[model samples]
Target: MAKVSISLDAELVVEVMVLAGVGSPQDAIEAVVRDYIARGHRTEARTELKDEALRELDAKPQEPQG
Candidate 1:
């Protein structure tokens, strides 16, 4: 993978490091990013399941009216 250089606020980096419990700023940021991506994937999967269930309900035959 290619590496890129960027500047970030020192305070923000320290906060992230503390929250992530990682000694290195790079590892802290990376951990947060990976967690965010995983959360997004889980949310998307749940949405897909809900959509599929709705479609199935729509496709089911209804009882005739009295």
Candidate 2:
């Protein structure tokens, strides 16, 4: 694993700790980043599913009712 050193706002770090429910800065940051990536993946999956559904709908044959 690569180690990085950067400055962040103190309040932001504290908030991350609270929101992420983690003890240390590293854990908090990692949790938040993982959550963000997971959410993005879920959003992409949903979009793909919707597009697939639309394509399937378009491909289906239509029936005429009497």
| Candidate number achieving the greatest lDDT relative to the actual structure | 1
lDDT of 1 by residue, 21-57 (tens): 9999999988998999999999999999999999999
Cα lDDT of model 2 by residue, 1-66, tens digit: 888787889899999999888899988988888899999999999999999999999999989878
| Residue 2, candidate 2: alpha-carbon lDDT | 86
Clash count for each candidate, listed in order shown: 0, 0
Pairs in steric clash, model 1? none
Candidate 2 structure, TM-score to reference: 0.79
State in Å the error of residue 11, model 1. 0.7
Off by over 4 Å in 1: none
- Whole-model lDDT, candidate 2? 0.92
RMSD of each: 1.3, 2.5
What TM-score does candidate 1 get on C-alpha atoms?
A: 0.87
Top candidate when judged by TM-score against the true structure: 1
